[model samples]
Target chain A: DQQVKQNSPSLSVQEGRISILNCDYTNSMFDYFLWYKKYPAEGPTFLISISSIKDKNEDGRFTVFLNKSAKHLSLHIVPSQPGDSAVYFCAASNGNAGKSTFGDGTTLTVKP
Target chain B: GAGVSQSPSNKVTEKGKDVELRCDPISGHTALYWYRQSLGQGLEFLIYFQGNSAPDKSGLPSDRFSAERTGGSVSTLTIQRTQQEDSAVYLCASSPQPYTANTGELFFGEGSRLTVL
Candidate 1:
């Protein structure tokens, strides 16, 4: 069973537009959620994260919203740029264990 | 290297052969993890190592898959009698904190792509 799921396989948006990616998890034990951005031929890098205690966390142009009631979370990027064109993976862990379950990832293409 | 380092960025082997992939995490980092990504699939957890504590192997897919971290530094993932389905990009990551209040962000290495022919 996939504990974490990202239903959208790919998303496209024009530069300067908002890009939103969604994720869902079935494991209620998960208390920490993270977003990673990956470029072609490279490993994933940490983007942003939020704890269960909070519903929203923002950094620069990236923001993450967590909805514990629905077991859902989302990553929103404002004024998406071409540099943001890459695969984004959503991950979650129960606590400080550091073993995170990841989503299938969504490829975002920002058109110029 | 300043970040996690993985050897043999690409590897090709015949089915039934054993393969070993190595990872060197950032110095002083106590938490290490292994994950694999197959074509059109998500990153699948494999195993985890934290400090001198016992490693977490619950995510190993089969007995043929095993990993070890020696001296709480370098780690090696071994696959015995590999199968074609085992082909994927193996990713290694390390974190500075594993037991305290932290951001839970992982620094990852450029995965090693394994192809079982």
Candidate 2:
């Protein structure tokens, strides 16, 4: 069973526009969530994350919003840049160390 | 040397042959993870290893797959009698601390592509 899901397979946005990626989880035990960005032929890198106790977290131009009641979270990139184009994966963990479940990933493309 | 390193980045083997994939986590990192991604699919967890404690093998797909971590550092994932269905990209990751609210991210390797023909 897929504990985490990213319904969108791909998204395209213009540079300097807002880009939002959504993710949902079926397991209620997940207490921590993270977003990762991956480029072609490279490993995924950490992006942003939020704890279940918090509703929102922000870093630089990326912000993550968590809605616990709905078991949903989203990553918002404001003024998206072409360099932001990559596959983004949503991962969730149930207060564990290395057992995070990942989504199928959403490919985001930013056009200049 | 710097980040999580996985060797045999590309391996092609015949069905029924055993294959070994290696992972060297970042120096000083304590938690290591193994995951595989098949075509058109998401990352599939295979195993996890922590310092000196028992490894978590709950995610292993079958009895043919086994992994071991030595000296709390290097790890090897062995797939015995591999099948064509085993073809995928195997990824390894490491973290300084257990994935928690305090440490929410992992450093991943580029991944080892295994092609079982």
Candidate 3:
């Protein structure tokens, strides 16, 4: 059973546009949510994250919104660039444990 | 090697052979994790270690898979009597204690790819 789910297999966006990636989880105990970006032959790279207590967190061009009631979270990259093209994975974890469950990734391609 | 480091970037072994994967986590990080990724798949948790507490091996696929974290710094994962299904990229990640804060950002290695023939 997949506790975390990224329904969309891929996303495409134009340059300088807003690229949004969505994820959902079935576990209510998960207190931490994170987003990772990966390129070919490389491990995932941390992008952004949000806590259960907060609704929104932003860093530079990237932002993450969490809606606990809906058990959904999204990553938004404003003014998407071609370099932003990659596979994005969402992960959730309980606050105390060392393990984080990951969802099937969404491949994002930002066209220049 | 400021970030997590993994050895044997690529390995090809025949079936029924044993293989060892090593990971060197970032200095001073208290938590380490192992994950597997098959082609076109997401990260699969294999194991993790928190300080001196017993390592969480709940994600191991079977008894053939085992991992050990020595001195809370480096970790090794061993797969015995490996099968063709065990071939995948094994990744290592690390984080500071209280990982929830700071977005729980995990530093990951390039990963070790294993192929069973």
Top-scoring candidate (lDDT): 1
lDDT by residue (tens digit), candidate 2, B5-106? 999999999999999999999999889999998876778889988788899999999999999999999999999999999999999999987563465788
- Those runs of model 3 whose alpha carbons end farther than 4 Å from true positions after fitting are B98-100
Worst 10 residues of 2 chain B by lDDT: B97-106
Error of 3 at A14 (Å): 0.8
**Per-residue lDDT tens digits of candidate 2, residues A1-112?**
7889999999999999999999999999998899999898788899988889899999999999999999999999998999999999998988673578899999999999
Ranking by lDDT: 1, 3, 2
Candidate 1: segments with Cα more than 4 A from true spot: none
Between the candidate structures 1 and 3, which one is better when assessed by lDDT?
A: 1
TM-score of chain B of 1: 0.96
User: Which regions of candidate 2 fall more than 4 Å away from where they truly are?
Assistant: none
Task: Specify the CAPRI tier of model 2.
Answer: medium
User: Among the candidates, what TM-score does chain A have in each?
Assistant: 0.98, 0.98, 0.97
Task: Give the whole-model CA lDDT for all candidates, comma-separated.
Answer: 0.93, 0.91, 0.92
What is the Cα-based lDDT of residue A106 in candidate 2?
97
DockQ of 2: 0.70
Candidate 3, TM-score of its B chain: 0.97
Clashing pairs in 1: none
TM-score of 1: 0.97
